[model samples]
Target: MAMYALTEVTKRFTKGRKEVRALDGVDLTVADGDWLAIQGPTGHGKTTLLQLLGALDRPSSGSVLFDGDDLARLSERRLAGVRARSFGFVFQFFNLIPTLTAQENVETALVPLKVSAASRRERAGRALADVGLADRSGHLPAELSGGQQQRVAIARALVTEPAVLLADEPTGNLDEDTRDEIIALLEGLWKDRGLTLITVTHDSTVARRAPRIAWISKGKVSLRKDDRRAARSRAVTTEPKDADSAAVGGAVATAEQSAAPVTTTEPRDAGGTAPGGRVALPEEATAAE
Candidate 1:
């Protein structure tokens, strides 16, 4: 079943006197339990598209169907309900409240759903354990390492038991080693929980991990199926000098596999007019709060 279906979706922003179209006539469908990686240059509408999917923002025109309901037509209250109950989001920066303990940070996600305090605490504890952060539940974000803080953020996102996970630049701020650890954790969670995972990343290494890749350019999108299974097999079987070398080798192998013939689907009228200027939007603040 299709968890999300976007047809002729376009998002526009008014900057000065000129209108900037971040997403132009985008058409894409993501199936339930599918993993989709979106990669594109900065200011090219990757985040705009993700915002639409997560119900953080509405489109300027066209339909954004989530499980057959048109999000564009929904009232703001209904959209907020959908976001609170159906979607979980992890951002690039660990957006944990500095004063809150790890468990407390996670519990906040349940507050909007009106979960009892005791139940929220219990669920938050379990979520931290799921992300391998149970031992650090009492620690503040300042006390934890970058990787641990990201884990706490992940835990917070999952505490609501959302059906879809929307992550934007999830590993962009971490070291390569930490990035790998976080990605592994997310991949495991997606498989075990049957989550519909959608991640937007600029890193090719991260993008290649997904079974399907959506390349957005000039507010247009193209979808391609990747042979990640074969690439993973090659990475595991090959021996490298060190861990870093192994990762690089794996990326190379994945790139090679991607170069091979694969099925690709491009949106109708994919060509879009380039924006005269780009506006940097603020990070999404709803997920953790």
Candidate 2:
């Protein structure tokens, strides 16, 4: 059975008199240990989907099942437990606590689980070391470089040892070189830690690394062609009438409008694992709704 399955799920938001439909009859299945990329243009429900997948939000209608337990049916307390125990989240902005050292920041992930102080510190230390930030563990966010701060954020996410890691635009804040490093680290962790890795991204360079890609458009999802040759063939055959419809909200036009553009990045030789991603803009949530 799939680890996560969404059945015709929909999410609607109402603020004042305005109502927005963020997800429209979306259905998808994610298998265990699957490295799935969820990509689309801005305000197209990508982040909303991630929120639903991570149990951060509930759907308006239909079902969201994690390991066959319906998230929609869970009470808030139960849902919180599921999120704390089963999932780890990274966001677009580092979201590190500025006052805390890297190790202290990582250890906070264990606080909700009520882990003992000694065990929490030990696990946090191991997680930071895994991300190659053991030496920087004593440094505060202000003392670390942007990349190092992001590493600390990643270590915090992994300290809980979650089975599923949800990353929303993980590389959005970094320079080109740092973006590549974070992507390689995430891919390595997905492999080494046997995580069900799901990422939401706009960067073409990062999307191509995933084995499966799901494209969301108009609040619905469709499977993307992952093979380069097949994608090219489809691009060549796309209807001329669809060209204008492809570009929206100041985004660039691509043959596969539903899919994020797939661009190549130079090969990286790094082998270590890390965790990273920051929450998207606050507007993203309301926009999705």
Top candidate (TM-score): 1
Q: Report the lDDT of model 2 for residue 58.
A: 82
For lDDT, the strongest prediction is: 1
* Candidate 1, 1-289: lDDT as tens digits: 7889999999888877978888889999888877899976676788888888988778899999999999999997898899889999898877888999999999989988899999999999999999988899999999999999999989988999999999988998899999999999998898789898999998989988887788887787887665545534563475687999888877777777767555445443336543423222232353210
RMSD of 2: 12.6
lDDT of 2 by residue, 136-157 (tens): 9899999998888878878888
Question: Which clashing pairs does model 1 show?
Answer: none
lDDT of 1 at 109: 90
User: All candidates: CA RMSD in angstroms?
Assistant: 6.6, 12.6
Computed on alpha carbons, the lDDT of every model, listed in order, comes to 0.82, 0.77
Model 2 bad stretches (over 4 Å):
226-289
Write down the TM-score of every candidate.
0.82, 0.79
